[model samples]
Target: MRDITMYQSNGENELFVEQSVAQLPQLSGDTVTATIEIDAGQTYQEIDGFGASFTDSAAYLIHQVLDGEQRTELMSKLFDPQDGIGLSFLRNPMGASDYARTVYSYNDLPENGTDPELSGFSIAHDEADIIPLLQQALKLNPEIKLMASPWSAPGWMKTSGSMLTGQLKPEHYQVYADYFVRYIQAFAAHGLPTYAVTAQNEPLYEPQHYPGMLMLPEEQLVFIRDYLKPSFINHGLDTRILCYDHNWDRPDYPLTVLEEAAAEVDGVAWHWYGGAPAAQSEVLAAYPGKEVHFTEGSGGEWIPPFEQAFSNVMRTGIEILRNHSKSFVLWNMALDEQNGPTVPGFGKSTCRGVVTVNQQTRELTYTLDYYALAHFSKVIRPKALRLDSAASNELVRSVAFRNPDGSVAAVLFNDGEAEETVAVKLQGEEVLTFSMAPKSAVSLKVDSK
Candidate 1:
C-alpha cells in the first residue's frame, strides 16, 4: 500500500485538514469517468518557493503585539514545515509601503537635505521590529528566502523632497544604487540574506497618498545597466537583480527593460492587479531562460466571501506557476483584525492578509488566503520541478510538482458547483483517487514508495 496525504479546504469556509488515505481501489472493468494523468517525464521550472510579504505593519504586529509564547506559536505555524504551512518564500518593503506605521526610509534626511555619499545610511529602523521577527522565522525554517523592494526612494533622492509623488532625480542614480548595496550587506550581517531585489515597487505609477516613485523602462535600463548592477558587482554581492515590479498587463514594461538591460538583470517580477497570468508565457517566449516571479498580489475586500477568495487564490496560484513563475509571493503576511493599521491618512482599507490579528485582544485568526497558500508551500519544496499533468474534467484545475525527494504533490481546485472525484494516474500507472468539494481546493501528496 502506498501512503498518500490530502490537505483540503472545503466549501464550508473552514481551514485545511490533513488526512491519510491508505490505498487506492483500482478502477474496475472499463471505468466510464476520466482520470487525471501525471507525467514526470515532462518537467518545468524549479520552484524557488511560495509565500507572502512581511510588511512594516505585519512585522510590528507580530513583534510588538503578541506575547512571547503566542509569538513563538504563531511564527512556528507560519514557518515550520512539520508543524505549519511551511511558507518558504517571502518579501519585505525596503522602506515604507502603504501598510507602514509611518513613511520613512533607511537613509532619511531632513528637508532639502542631500547625502550623495550616503554616510548617514542605517538600517536601525528595521532593526527595531522587522529583523527580530525575521530572525524567529528563519529559526523555524532555515531554508526560507527573502526578497525585498522599495516603494519609494529616500525623499532626498526625489524632486519633491518627500516620499510622495515625485520622480527620482537623474543625478542621484549612483547613490541610490549604493543604498541597495548597503541594504543587502546589512541584512546578510543579521543572518538574513536577500536572494533578490527589484529596482522599485510598482514603478509605472505614483500614488497620491502613499510612498511611491515613478520610474519608467528607460530609467530602469539606465539605472540597472549603469548603476545598480555595477554597485552589486563592485561590492562582490551575488544577490539577483529583478526589474519591473508591476502588473501582468504591462508585459512590455519588463520586456522593454530586458531588451537592453537583460544582462544586468536576472528576471522579471510581476503583480496581479492588472492583467492575465498568460502574460508570463509571452515574456518567456521572447527570453527563455529569464525567470518570472509573482512578487506581489493581495486578496481583499472587493472579493470578501470566503469561498470566492479560496477559488480565486488557488486558481490564480496554479495558473501563474503553470505559466512558469519560480515563486508565488502575496502582499502581506498578517494584518490587524480591521484589515489594517494602514497608512494613517488613507480612509478605507481593502486588503486581506494571510492571517489577522486582533490588536485589542491580541487574538489571531488564519484567513482562507492562508490555507490557499498552504496547498502549495506546505507540499512543494524549494527547487521542486513542476511536473506535467492533464485533467479530463473541466473543473479540475490541477498543477503537479515532483519534489526533490521524488514524491509528487498535485494541487487541484474544483471550480464547478459540485463535488467531483477522480482517479490519479501516475506515469500511466494507476495510483490514487480523491474527491474535491466544489469551489474548494485540495493538495495531494504521493510518497515515492
Candidate 2:
C-alpha cells in the first residue's frame, strides 16, 4: 500500500489537500472506473519546473508596499516547497517590460549617439527594485532557475532610435550581443545569476507604445549564429539562448531558426497570446534534439468569477506539458489592485498578475493563477520527466510525471459537469481511486513502490 497525497481545486476547494489514502484496491477489470495508466517505463522531456515571472511591477509591489513580516510571509508562501508552492523556475525581464513601472533599458543613450564599445552599458536601473526582490527570492529558493527576456534593446541599437517599435539595426548586432553579456555578468555580480535568456520577447510583434522590437526569423538566426553565440563564448557565459519568443500561430518562425541556427541556439520560447499549444509539439517533432518552453501567459481583470482562470490555466498547463514543453511560466507574479503600475501607452491593462497586492492597504490576494500554478509547482521538482498518461475523454484531461525523488505526480482536470471517479493505474495495478469533482484540477502524488 502506497500513501497517496491528493490536492484538489474546484471553486470551493482551492488547492485543498482533501485526503491521504494509504492503499489501493486489488486490480480487477470490472472494478475499474476510468483508468489512467501511468507508464514510468516511457518518459519524455525533463521538466525544468513551473513558475511565473518576476516582472518590474511585481518586484516593485513586493519591495515598496509590503511590510517586512508580510513580505517574508509572501515569499515563503511563494517559493517554499514545504510551506508553500515550490516554484522552481522564474522568468526575469532583461530590462523594462510592459509590466514595468517605466520605460528604460540598460544601455540608454542620447539622440544620435552610439556606444559601439558598450562603455555606458549598465544594469543600474534594475538595481533599485528588481535586484533586491530577486535577491530575496533566491534566498528563499537557491535552486530556482531564472530565464531573462528583453522586451526591447536600447534605442540606439534599434533602427527606429526608440524603445517603442523598431527592429535591431544590422550594424549594432555585435554591440547588442555584448549588451546581453554585460547584463548577465551584472546580474551575477548582484548574486542572482541568470540561467538562460530568450533573444527577444514576441519578436514578430512590435507594439508602437510599450517597449518592443521586431526581429524576424532570419534576423534572429543571423544574430544568434554570427553575433550572440560568439559573444557568449567570448564573455565565458554559458547562459542558454532560446529563440522565437512569439506566438504559436507561425511555427515557421522557430522552425526556420532551428533549421539555420540550431547549432547556436538552445531551444524555442513561446507565448500563448495567439495560436494553439499543439504548435510546440510540432516544433519538437521536427527537432527532437532541441527543447520547447512555454515562456509567458497571464490572467487578470479579463477573467470573471476567478474560478474560470484556474480552469483555463490548468488546461493550458496540461496541454503544454503533454506537448513536450519542459518549462511553463506565467507572466506577472504580482500586481496592484488596479492591475498595474503600467507604463503609459502600453496595452494589456486588464492583464492581472498571479497575485494582487493592494497598494494602499498592503493586502495581498491570491488569484486562480496562483492555485493553478500550485497544482504543478508544488509537486513537480526540477528534472522530473513527463510520464506516459492518457485520459478516456476530453472531459478528463491529465499529464503525469516521474519526480527525481522516485515519486509520481499526476495532475488531472475534470472539465465536465459531473464528478469523475478516476482509477490511476501504475504498471497495470490500480494504485488509487478518487472522485474528481467537476470543473476541478487535482494533483495526486504517490511514492514509488
Clashing pairs in 1: none
Model 1 CA deviation exceeding 4 Å by range: 23-34
Task: Tell me each candidate's TM-score.
Answer: 0.97, 0.96
Question: What tens-digit string does per-residue lDDT give for candidate 2 at 1-449?
Answer: 78678887867445655554643334455544466888989999999988888788998898888888888888898898888888888999888888888888987889998989989888887787788878887788877888999999999888899989999999999888989998899899988778899999999888887999999999999999999999999889999999998888999999999998989999999888889999999998898878899999887666666667777898889999999998999999999988898888765588878889999888998877888888998878889999999765568898999898999999988878887778888878877777777888888888877
Cα RMSD, each candidate: 1.5, 2.0
Residue 426 CA error for candidate 2 (Å)? 0.8
Q: Could you tell me how far off, in angstroms, the CA of residue 323 lies in candidate 2 after the best superposition?
A: 0.8
Candidate 1, run of 10 with poorest lDDT: 23-32
